[model samples]
Structures are given as structure tokens and as C-alpha cells.
Target: MTQWTAEQPIVSIRDVHKSYGQVEVLRGISMDIMKGEVICIIGPSGSGKSTLIRCINALNDIQAGSIQVEGQEVHDAKLDKLALRRKVGMVFQQYNLFPHKTALQNVMMAPIKVLRENPAEVEARARALLKKVRLEGKENHYPGELSGGQQQRVAIARSLAMRPDVMLFDEVTAALDPETVKEVLVTIKDLAADGMTCILVTHEMGFAREVADHIYFTDRGVIVEHGAPAEFFTNAQDPRTRAFLDQVL
Candidate 1:
């Protein structure tokens, strides 16, 4: 395995901060994500795991510090937000597919509209991506007709259609039924195996242990601990990390 700790960063966050009204969320956080690294972040609800990643893709603006992706500043005033988004795909807990569109249509829209790719080519790639996520024949199925897991898979295919450099998954399996969670997890595992850079914020400790190259523990708006799966899971040093692990693991 490559030593990600020594590698140049694909996403670099420096002393980041975020807040809502009078309440502060992220507080002076810093981390560098290396290319082809699968990073999983775990924490209690309201610990700012989602917020941090949101800032990474500029979904939420930071109050202080900077986030750089592939040498481009994410929050720069003149930054081409749409262009940045094309390089960083994000999946949320809810399967936010367009109700009126078929699975394939959902996956094909961005590449066609935003990237202005040939419609025929986009359709072909969409079909392949849907199949990659194990949705071989469901291309014609609408979101409402599919199960939550299948819908989530379509969401993944949609993100993959953009051909992003980094993928951020925020509690993707959280809303799925117990049995369906496995299918989504399997899809993500396959992506990891295919060498996609993934940053996942999940409550699925087992899945994180299996798929994540680095595990991060966040608490009260700060990264409290981080380590390789073996080190973080077995020999955590921070009290907050140990206590949280005690509850989850």
C-alpha cells in the first residue's frame, strides 16, 4: 500500500472554520487528502462531519481558512463553482433523484447539460455506470419505482457520470433498510477497489473498517483522532476517540 501520509495532497484544507448564526460548527480544522485515498469520517451526530465535507466541495462556505482542490482554491470569489463541482461528486443520505426522470436519464443529465457532451455518448456511459452499480436492467425505471438501495445506486451512477476526481458520500446508507444497506456498501467497496478517491462520512463502522484507508474521528467541530484502520480501531489514543469507539465498536 502507498503511504498516503507522505503523498502530495489532492484536497488540502487549512485552518477551516464554519458557523451558523451564533453557533460555531467547524473550528480551525486542517487536513490534506491524498489522491486515490479512501477516507472515512465517523462521529456522533452534530459533530460537523458533514459540514466539513460540504466545505470541501464549496456546498457550504467557510468563515475562515482555505480549501484547495488540485491546486485551485475552492472558495475563491471568481472560482468557477460549476467547474469545481464537476471534479468533486457528492452523494447524500437521501436518494435525491428527479422523480420524473428514469434512472438513466438522471445519470445522463449533467454530462449532457453541464459538460455539453454528445447525448449518445453520455447515454452509453450512463448505461455502463448504472450497470457498474449493479443496476443493469433498471435504466428505464423511475426513482419511485425503485427500492431505496436501487435509487441510491442510481444516485451513485449519476455522480460517477460526471467523472469526478473525488467522491464525497455523506451518510449514504443511513436511510436504507437493513438488508438494502449491503448492496450500497458493496457498490462503494467496488468503487474503492477500482481506485476512486472517496471521502465517506458514515455511521457504518463495519463498512468503514473494511473500505476506508484512513479513519477520522471528529467531535465538537474538530478532528480528534485519525489513524489507519488497524491503529484507530484497535489502539486509539485520544480519550474522545476511545470513548466513541467503545460505544460504536
Candidate 2:
């Protein structure tokens, strides 16, 4: 893993709360992500793990509290959501690729359109990113032509093309076949090793144990337990965390 110099947090969540109509999904949640940190969020379905990350990028609006990325308030009316999104890349479980576009085109599209970079340069960077993910030869393949793992890697490459300071992954390997999960996990592990600030919501305890600097266990819209991976996975002090781990792991 790349050695990260200890410094100020790159992302901060302060007393954040979210609700969909009358249904409260997040309740006064707070967390901090330091530069180059890999934080994993694990919880039962509907515990607000996904909602929290979505709110960080303004994909989901919060009813109360604050989320800040790189010291800029994410929910402020004057804040530019587009600019914030460009800095905080996200990868979803469903390899949300443009089926009509080839892998390289998909990676190049955002940097060319959003950042307004040179097309040739963006294409070259996209190709290099694909190669980094071990998808070099598959660049010309459309999403339909690739397997689930390949498409997910392309989605990751697409996100990385934005050169985000922080990456949010929401159950990225949940939909993959068991045999295919390792490849995607390997790519993510590489990112963690490279010291990319990452926040992942996943059920893969082994991956969390192996790569995450900190693991949070959430329940009923609250972060019930959080600690280093070694402590959280093996010696979690909370019963709720242990129960959840037993059921899932």
C-alpha cells in the first residue's frame, strides 16, 4: 500500500440525516475520511449505508445535517453539484455502462464532455486506465460483449477517468458471479494499495478485512460499531455487529 502522510480529512460527514418522505434512512450519522484512506461500510440491507454515500455526492438529498467533500459543503444551495460530482467518483453494483458505447468510449466520454479535455488525450488516458484494470484488449468491446466482471472493470475505469479525489463504491461486486467476484475485488484491492481515498459499501467481509483501513457496521440507520478491520471483524464489541457478521459471513 502507498504510504499516506497523516493529514486533514478529505471528506467529512457531520450529524447527517436523510429521509425519504416519512421513512428516515440515516440518523445523525458522522464520519471522516482522511486523505488516501480506504473505509468500508457494512450493514444489513436498508441500514443507510448506500444512502449515506449517495448523499456525499448529492445523488440523494438529505433532510438535515451536513456533508462536505474536500472542505466544500455538498448540500449548500450555492454549491455546484456538477463540480462536486466530478471530484467524487462513484461506482454502483450494477455496472451502469452505456451499452451502446465501447469500453474505451465509455471511459473517454465524461472527461471529454464534462472536463472538456482534448478527445485524443482523454482517449489515451482511458486506454491506459483500461490497461491498469487488465482490460486493455477489451477496449473496443461494447458492454453487451463483455462479461459482468469486465463491464464492472470498465465502469471503474470510467470513474477513474474523472481523476476523482475520492471514490464511492456501492456494493460493486454484489451482482457478480462468485467466480467473477475475485477479479473485480483484485482491481479494487489494487486501488486500495495505491492509496486512493475510497469508501465502499459491500457485503464482502473478506475483502473488507483484507483491504479496508476501517470498517463500520451499521444497523437501523445508525453506525453501531466502527474500528480497525482486525478489531471490527474478529473482536467487534457490539452484539448487533457480531450478529450481523454471523448472518452474513
Best by lDDT: 1
Write down the lDDT that model 1 would get. 0.93
Tens digit per residue, CA lDDT, model 1, 1-249: 243342679898999989998889998888888888999999999999999998889989989999988878898999999989998999989989999999999999999999999999999999999989999999999999999999999999999999999999999999999999999999999999998999999999999998899999999899999989988899999998899989987
TM-score of each: 0.96, 0.96
> Candidate 2 has which clashing residue pairs, if any?
none
| lDDT string, candidate 2, 66-158, tens digits | 888888889999989788988899999999999999999999999999899999899889999999999989989999999999999999999
RMSD of each: 3.3, 3.4
Q: Which 10 successive residues of model 2 have the least lDDT summed?
A: 1-10
Whole-structure CA lDDT of model 2:
0.92
